[model samples]
Target: MNVKGIHHLSAMTGGITVNYQFYTEVLGMRLIKKTVNQDDTSVYHLFYGDERGNAGTELTFFDFPGIRQNQKGVSSISGTSLHVRNDAALAYWIERFTEHDVTHSPVIPYAGRNVIFFEDPEGQELALVSDETNSGVPGGTPWEHSPVPAQYGIIGLGPVKLTVRKPESTLAALRLMGFTEKSRIPALVAGQEDIIIMQVAEGGSGGEVQVEPRDDLAIARLGKGGVHHVAFRIEDEEELLAWIEVLNREGLQNSGFVDRYYFRSLYFREPNGILFELATDGPGFDTDEPFETLGESLALPRFLEHQRESIEDHLRPLVTKRD
Candidate 1:
């Protein structure tokens, strides 16, 4: 079974309010879902994405108030890159960042694209890569309520950068999941490590994964602003189960099968310690609410419906302007 591309990239956050404002007001992504972590209902789970909350466009967060800042190093997802239409889109973002006082780096060239690096309120490394070649999935819909116009809004997730001590095992696991090496690039900055690019069978901008060797750096600690896990897309339950079997046969320990309500999931860790997940593409964000009114109110799965009262009472309420 071939893993298609990124389903969503989930990270940890310390302040939900600040995160909400930064992502919605500054980044211009739609707040697609406002729910609680299924494993830990006391905290909020926020999802931001393009219109319809499509598979490749999602960037989610788990709010853990008072959580310590993450220790960055090897064995972590260091950065997430979002795709922009072209150079003009990159320029638009630079201007927008300036107006909002967002911290950003000047546009630089890497991997045959112009990239502008930035950070969120909590310091999650992020970048906007100019996919001038229009190399992303076709027919991606932009959020209509986004402050940024649809023409320049992010197309989808671009190459995600992962820091690893060694690439052998990680590359092996990825190969089993249907990813093929695309290319490699030497480090542009002094003291930085070289990078290897991996792409799915249906290769494109969003389908790429960039791995940087950081063997000399210390291992990363999970905390606010660090990625919790990176999820890859599977077609449906059938593909999900097939992958579970494949992983089991390959002696890879994984979370058997998890019913996430919206989509089923399977969790595992690569040899380098970066958490990975295979998530189905169907029964998405709209499963709990209509597309027109997504992220409007607290949503709970059927099993958690009995605790909705307490869940809502324990968590702070969120109001999305466009919801």
Candidate 2:
């Protein structure tokens, strides 16, 4: 199966405002869209990324207004590393974090790249890394609201980092999806050797890592403050279908195809228990809004038509026309 790259990453959160401030004001991503969660209208489904909010550029969050912040452990998502242009950008981000008083660790190497690690207000881990490997595919077409200049904006998502209870089951599923053993590194923090790294050879999206849980033996499971799923990108429907066949042969559960407005998605779970999605790149974010205004307002795929009004009501106003 020919998998293009990462599509988008989704995580759960506690509030809409904190997400808006962290993703935009702190990280400098453009607030491309302000919409509500299609599944639950009361919460917002916010997307922050480059001007165009391209596939890999996306970091989406679902806000559950009063939910308690969840623990970050073996069964939770570890972190997401975003690819940037160089150390200059990385340094700029370090200073940016300092200016906001957001605590973060110094740069460290992992999977053959230098990365700056930090946490969102709700404790979701995120990283910014220089594109030293130059592996990311070209970012999608430009959009107006992006904060970084179009050229230096993200090319695509570097690999995602996942921590699971047992690595074997997830490793089996990743192999079936064509991910290969890249290398094994010492745990990024310290006093740990339970880390394993994997890469998608054909993917232009960057790299992904899966780690063994620090204290137990089970797949990382999703919950209130956990990552909802990780989406991998494919060139088109045919390539997507081929992978569906590979997944079935491996006995993994997969939902054939579902239209998600801009792109068609195939959903499944990896062996270590993380939700995985395979999404097509077409009918992209540019489909609903013109390339000129891709992230300007609420955009609901046709399937969620009836809930639009309520979705709008619950979201705290973000990038307004004036700003």
Candidate 3:
């Protein structure tokens, strides 16, 4: 079975308040889930997405109290993208970013699409891509009450950018996973000159990965403003099970059949040390919380429910409610 497009991206953040304000108010995505990191149980794991917290729309973050800023280099998820419906949406964002005093670049072309690359307050690399011509995998619905108008709101995730040491090694692993080499183009990404490699499934932006090969940089140091992992969409649990075997058959050592509560997952690392996960799309954020009151309170997986009090003990309060 083949995989779908992007599922969600988990990243690191140093502070919760500023990060929350930037994503919910500035970016205008809904805070769909307020939870603690299952692995650590001490830090906040916040999820921002479209109104319903759809699979392809989640951009999640894990909070670490005093982490260092990310050292930009090879072997990192260099950039994350958000999909907007058209050129007019991009224009609206340019104005909004300016009004908010957000640091952003003018619109530029790369790998057959026009995107406006920008950075969050903590130096998280982000792009707003124009989906005017996208016909591959579709984007999700925008939050109706988003500070940014619904018509120009950030819909779903776009292509994820991976910075690796060897292009061939990363590309080889991708081919085995069903991604096709769509196009390769050169562009200045975050002030560095490198080749932007596009690996995609036909014309779907969510199914795309922009891989940059750089021989002149050091391995990235993970901290605040760094991507922890990028998960690809597996249409169902059955396909995810098949992917477990596929990854093993390809000689890749992976975490086989992990039940993430919301979805099942399989985790592995490609040749370049970038973490990748194959995840099922259903049993989503709505599973534990009702649609109307999503993100209004802290949510925990059933497995973590018994320790909710202890987990809540370590959490620092940052009000997650919005208008």
Best by TM-score: 1
- TM-score per candidate, chains pooled: 0.97, 0.87, 0.96
Root-mean-square deviation per candidate = 1.4, 2.9, 1.9
After superposition, candidate 1 runs with Cα above 4 Å error: 134-136, 188-193, 321-323
Q: Supply candidate 1's per-residue lDDT for 77.
A: 94
List model 1 lDDT by residue over 78-197, tens digit each: 989888888999999999999999999999988878999999988889999887865645425788888999888987788888888897778898899889998899964567667888
lDDT by residue for model 2 (1-323), tens: 64555678888887677777777666667666666676677777877767667677777888776776665566445678777776676777677678898879888775677778888887777777777665545554333445655544554566687777667877777776667776777765666555777667454335465555454433344444568888877778787778778778878788987777677788997765678888887766666667556556777877776867866776667553424
Q: Model 3 — TM-score against the truth?
A: 0.96
Candidate 1 clashing pairs? Answer: none
lDDT string for model 3 (139-248, tens) is 88988888889889988999998888787788887777778877766645465445655545554678888888777789999999899999988788888888878887
Poorest lDDT segment (10 consecutive residues) of candidate 1: 132-141
Which scores greater on TM-score, model 2 or model 3?
3
